[model samples]
Target: MGEENLLPNKQIVLKNYLQGCPKETDFELRTTKVSTEIPHGSKGVLLKNLYLACDPYICHLMRPRGLSILSSHGFIVPGSVVRGYGVAKVIKSGYEELKEGEYVWGITSWEDFSWNFYPQQLLIKINITHDVPLSYYAGILGMSGLAAYVGWNEICCPKQGEIVYVSSGAGGVGHLVGQFAKMMGCYVVGSASTNQKVDLLKTELGFDDAFNYKQGDLRSKLNKYFPKGIDIYFDNVGGEMLDEVMLKMNINGRIAASGMISQYNLKEPQGIHNLFSLIEKRLSVRGFMVLDYKEKYPEYAEWAVKKLQEKKLVYVEDVITGLENVVSAFVGIYHGLNIGKRIVVVAEE
Candidate 1:
């Protein structure tokens, strides 16, 4: 639709299935000509990806050699583009409903230009009446936000004055969960990787207390903080963290297993020796995924946006520019390098 100089595209391809922890070397940058205009009579639309949300769960898709199942959450083949949730602008459209210049957010690939068929799944349109940053739709208003809400309300079902502890508290879902817990009048505590993150949780996110998991003894630290034992554990990081929390959970406690970022990269997961404690304490630990709760998106969105408008809920984001840098941006999530929601600003228009 335009001269070669007018349309430029940047893309990423899967180099290989990672053996253990994913490295940036497992992805490669590729470029090609991409026109902003869609072809006439085309059944597919073209989009300029504006933001890419990096989530910890994505690490599960990095299959190791000889593994039969590539991903438990989603299948990703070698040489295919990495997929994620993002916000984009429709430069071209084949459907009568989706017009050019409209903004949409949903599951999208890690690339500059994407032809989103079944727009219902790949592209969920955004109403700009809110006029918040487009990247906000990619994180706080997108899947990560839904995870926080569903994990807390649907899974944990907390009551007022309940003690809530969230692992990876400064992360995308963890941050929002802490705020929502506070809004519910629950006593909240969070665990983060750094002292600055702990400070942010205590002072900014309104947690009752927060601890840096990297410093000192985890069990000793948790015991000191939750002297009476935790009533609910919103687990993001697993392994020893979960084990430690299991030892300190009260009778009839609930554990919402949102994710285990600790085990995503490990070939064999570390032992959770305290599972027996669940029986003695009568604790309930349940794991869930968002797709199973798609029916709740509309209701959850309404509730969350109202909180946003009323200033009852807040979030943070770490944004990088250009599709060229998306690989590194995603790598940051696995390494605890990003403080908030990690997103890549791929292209504006």
Candidate 2:
């Protein structure tokens, strides 16, 4: 490849390991030139990034190394391209399964283009047979969707007429969990930080009731919404909220401990003082990772696609154009600035 033909690749690199809440200054955007051609006998695939999902869990990776369990898997290093899930098009591939011109969604860097040498298992080929939006693979049909499906269906085992509650109800994953519970005939209630999000849940998302967690006492809010006690709790914001919900759970209730957005930025995570209630209520609390349920993705994807086509399911996305705004878009999630799933658009497909 000629040097003149090289493409200018823009990237978002972590400036340092985060100490408190992430700031826009914590990331630095840089440009570098790269050739699009794949090397001979290489097992890598070149990608053109389209949309990137802004998830709260990525904040955990920003913490100092050895501060959390995720550090073992490798934390975000200073002056390196930030990594996250994104939708991309295969530009040049030495791998047979991932052919050129195909779309894939998986773990890719925050750059305009990326080369994945070990994509045999990391990148998942997107099936576009249904003509759905490619961006959906970054949110509703991707990790968020799979996380909600496994947490609600397999872990919670929700039944018809059951009472369910979701924390951070309008988030990327929480929104889907509430919708799934509702589809199963469960009466669902969700909590958000703002009244706008609370209204979106009840009026648009079909939740039975919604509450702004910042407005009143946590226990009072739960009591008002779940007078009969909650049977299923899809916990996205842990810490104090989980502690409060434990006291209001019905006998044999199930709790899916997904993400803990509340304590992600805390130097010392808040302690849960309601374990006694768990034993008293015979509650089952299970912390699950979406990767554990990879085999069931096809099942969930089929159901999600069908519901979407029938207009039975609704997904809202707060999209910001350009990689320059990626830092602000990500930081906004922690502060509850986004109404739904937040996505950064890098390029149009």
TM-score of each: 0.93, 0.97
The local lDDT score (0 to 100) that residue 161 gets in candidate 1 is: 95
In the range 236-323, model 1's lDDT, one tens digit per residue, is 9889999999999999999999988898788788999998989999999999887677789888877877887887777789888878
RMSD of each: 2.6, 1.5
lDDT of 2 by residue, 1-349 (tens): 6887588999999998898899998999999987877787998999999999998888778766534433223578788888888899999899989899999998888999998887876788998989779999999999888998899888898889999999999998988889989899999999999999999999999999999999878888888888899999999999999999999999999999998889989888899999998889999999988887889999989999999999999998889999888999999999999887899999999
What C-alpha lDDT does candidate 2 achieve relative to the native structure? Answer: 0.89
Best candidate per TM-score, number?
Answer: 2
Worst 10 residues of 2 by lDDT: 65-74
User: In lDDT terms, which candidate is top?
Assistant: 2
Indicate the TM-score of model 1: 0.93
**Model 1 CA lDDT for position 300:** 83
